[model samples]
Target: MDLLSRGSMVSRHGLVLLLLLLIGCVYADSDDQVFLEINDHKMTTLSNMSNGSGRNEQICTLCEDFASQTLSYLQDHETQTAVISGLHQVCSKLFSLKHQCLTMVDYYVPLFFANVALIQPEEFCQKVNLCEMMASLRLPNRDGPCTICHNLVVEFLTKLKDPDLQLEIIEVLLKACGKVEDHVQECKKLVFHYGPLVMFELEKFLETTDICAAIHVCKASQGAAVAATLLADA
Candidate 1:
């Protein structure tokens, strides 16, 4: 029920994410199938919280508590698809929450770090089962899909020990970095928040120190600019 916005709160952990997946189950009028189809059997809070079914509201409250309490437990162990499905059901309700919901989708999303497969380029897609449907989640009312969500999915796909999948993830994320730069604020925040990981990727995938310095420049500000220049000179 507590929905915090990102622009308002600041903590040592960085921006306080205001994402609350509290929508209960929703019952479609037999014509609605996006839930069953796109969600892949995962029930979101919106689907469960719809007023159409009196049961939806009750399920929403119960699932909300369950998600808040059990998140740590789920993260500790190997979070299977079954568990993710349940969580997705709860999170989907969040889409309809126009006000007072957290915007921290990035935090709660499951991250799967997978390795790349070393096969011929032709066989790569087949070997890894790399389909867009399985690779990314479409954001509500967005133009194209987001690499951020896909990055997490790619991480999950790598669980099969496919190195090709890992390479795909790297390429995907690098492309995402370019997109992030388009929004200066998002790029700076992403770099600062996930600097170590970004640095790791920069070192491995990109074969240059200039790119890292450029990232630092992207993160720098007025006084920070002078320091960046000094670092670049060194």
Candidate 2:
């Protein structure tokens, strides 16, 4: 199975991806049940590609492919220029990937879905004229939980060995949701009541977070600094 790593070779259309059908994970129960089976799930490829189950391997391979092939499709056809372009600027920075990695559909899919509930990603997909194309996949449907998205993040955290870079990306996602400052105040208010706990929880939630990991650190850092000052003043 092909993987997403700094040194991994990416075929333009992921003919490697084309050979497989990526089945996105579906919740048998609830979000809380997600990690219950973490032990059963195979070690991610980054850690030990040789150790995981066929299913887990498929998830990693497919996800890597999804990130690759989908973006290739979009780029070739000019699917969602605005959203695609915006995500390009963000994902590469967050994941410490080259700008070329923006071609990975799986990389940005969760971030896109992260906004769907609150921001209606459909609007952006429509803007890019990819609504119908995405729906045809019949993967998780509209109301499904973000299981697949979580897996994608783990692929990055596990596959990419730079813990500092991973942590940075995770922080960007948790606080900035794409690492963009568009909603820092909302995040600040949530963290204000339980800053340490929220930070801790965020660490655990790193794998499954829906944050877009888009913005520059300065954007979120400055906004967070201002919020802290306001809280101190109060």
Candidate 3:
């Protein structure tokens, strides 16, 4: 080819390459900038959601009080001193209050579980009343049924990372459920439902060298069985 023609063709090729590079850079910058904006918007939405969230503080207060009162009733009243005494009236009232208080706890307990470590031990003690009361009442009323009232135990296991607590809770629950023939059916379903999830966590917990951590995996496995038994026996 002639020198002039060759020079013209080279100039055109160089210009095309430069144009393509500029177009590619523009698209890359646009994508990066758009992704940053999306992330920033998500952060802003999350912040607003957090700020606006509030729980039923009134319900929480009542639950705490009723649980405390019921515990005090057990401590002060002791074994039935007399069948005809007005102490029976107080006991009835206290039991009634405990049941009512658990309803409130059911609504607010998830919130408490979210930040469980920050909550005072006394608060946890009060909350334990709700679990114990629900487990004890065996109420016929379907208003707020006892479906996995031990959810707090599972959550505690997840956060506390203690196997002994997991096993203790499992044993206590097994003892509670073993008494009731009616619980067999429900326990069977529960076993299938929560078994795999807790097992997965237990497997993870087993990897740790800490004895305390090791205990959790062992207990979690038991706890899952206890949960299964609840539905199984029903």
Alpha-carbon shift of residue 67 in model 1 (angstroms): 17
The order by descending lDDT is: 3, 2, 1
Worst 10 residues of 3 by lDDT: 1-10
Looking at model 3, residue 77 earns an lDDT score of 25
lDDT of each: 0.29, 0.32, 0.33
Q: Model 2 — which ten-residue stretch has the worst lDDT?
A: 18-27
Cα lDDT over the full model 2: 0.32
Error of 2 at 66 (Å): 4.1
Error of 1 at 4 (Å): 14
lDDT head-to-head 1 vs 3, winner? 3
Candidate 3 off by > 4 Å: 1-160, 183-196, 199-234
Candidates arranged by TM-score, highest first: 2, 3, 1
Model 2: residues with Cα > 4 Å off, grouped in runs: 1-47, 55-69, 76-145, 162-234
Residue 61 displacement in candidate 2 (angstroms): 11
| lDDT string, candidate 3, 1-234, tens digits | 111112232232222222222222222223465334433443343333233333344334433543443334323322112211322232233343433323323332333223433444346434333333223223233322122332323333343344544443333333332322343333333334333444344433322212221223124455455445443443
For candidate 3, give the lDDT of residue 68: 46
Clashes of each: 27, 12, 17
